[model samples]
Target: MVDPAPAQTKLANEQVELNIPIQPLGAAISRYGNATGRDVLYDANLASGRLSSEVRGVFAPDEALNKLLVGTGLKAELITGKTFVLVPVPASQQARQTSSPEHLRYYGLIQAGITDALCDAQGAHPGRYRFTAKLWIAPDGAVVRSRRIGSTGTPRSDHEIDAALRRVQLNKAPPPGFQQPVIILIVPQGPGVTRGCDRP
Candidate 1:
């Protein structure tokens, strides 16, 4: 039997009719979400002083969302089948974070661990979808707590991700003064992309 498409994928491909006009970013997002039956989440401050791009016509929910975000210095990230969060672009985010070698090493370790955990599950692989999360790791390298920003488009996959993360223990502790609630962003791979699930 063929497996059904994941909820995230289905949501992205589903077309919706939208007639949102150029307006405040916050208001536009609201209208888009209401029209598409999806939830859009973002900090109010981020929407302040920003205007949305005009969007009209039938288009995939993702496409409409992208249109609304144009020139707004923000991007819509699907966290679940019906939820999205607006976050600053990667370029802007990178400018605010530490990029030292030590930090990079720790970041790699964290990502590798997360990848392994997600890959172990049938529908929770990283490269196939996109999501964001906040992780609180203890000094001893254990993921003491985790807060997922969105869904994997399915409750089963979301559960798998949460279960996997609860057991994650990095190889080493983070460097001194490392930040808490490490942000993790996983973006979908492009066409013809494939990734093996070899433990890191």
Candidate 2:
């Protein structure tokens, strides 16, 4: 006699499984405070299934989220058709599921490296040079966009910066799951070198 089909087999072709990193809302706020060297307090309200992190600063939500989950294996999901932070099904429940193509997190290492090189080549003056670079990243850290911000540098310097950034590629996954447009500020330390956003 023929055996009956399993229930999992029926749903295997109809669902998707995603693994996302989650941060304690409170810890995230505190970390952001420490990173920016700001002694500010943040408030988190998770009333309607949404987590709102409010801190006094100029950081975008995605930026803040990235900072919050630093070092955590978790990743954010920013797909247009899906909601954020959804719950994952139990492993037992997924036995028959046809898993979706895995997701990826793209980073901007090469672009960052080139920017550092340009900064080194440009020597630091007595003042600051605030420039912005547009980064193009893939789902798992493959840089797709590497253009200079429109108003972040001098006409001559901007061109140079653009050229420098073109050499960068997303060589690794960013944090995880989330991919969106990001603008970064590059401050020069000396000719062909620079540092992260801290010390002048």
For every candidate in turn, the CA RMSD to the true structure comes to: 17.9, 17.8
- Candidate 2 displacement at residue 39 in angstroms: 47
Global lDDT of each model? 0.71, 0.41
lDDT of 1 by residue, 9-74 (tens): 335577987888767777787777667767778888888866666688999988888877764668
Q: For residues 64-157, what per-residue lDDT tens digits would candidate 2 score against the true structure? A: 5444433222334544321134122334433322122332112244444554555454443212566666654444455555666554446765
Please estimate how well model 1 matches the true structure, expressed as its whole-model Cα lDDT: 0.71
Candidate topping TM-score: 1
Error of 2 at 153 (Å): 5.6
Give the residue spans of candidate 1 off by over 4 A. Answer: 1-97, 191-200
Angstrom error at residue 170, model 1: 0.2
Model 2, CA-based lDDT: 0.41
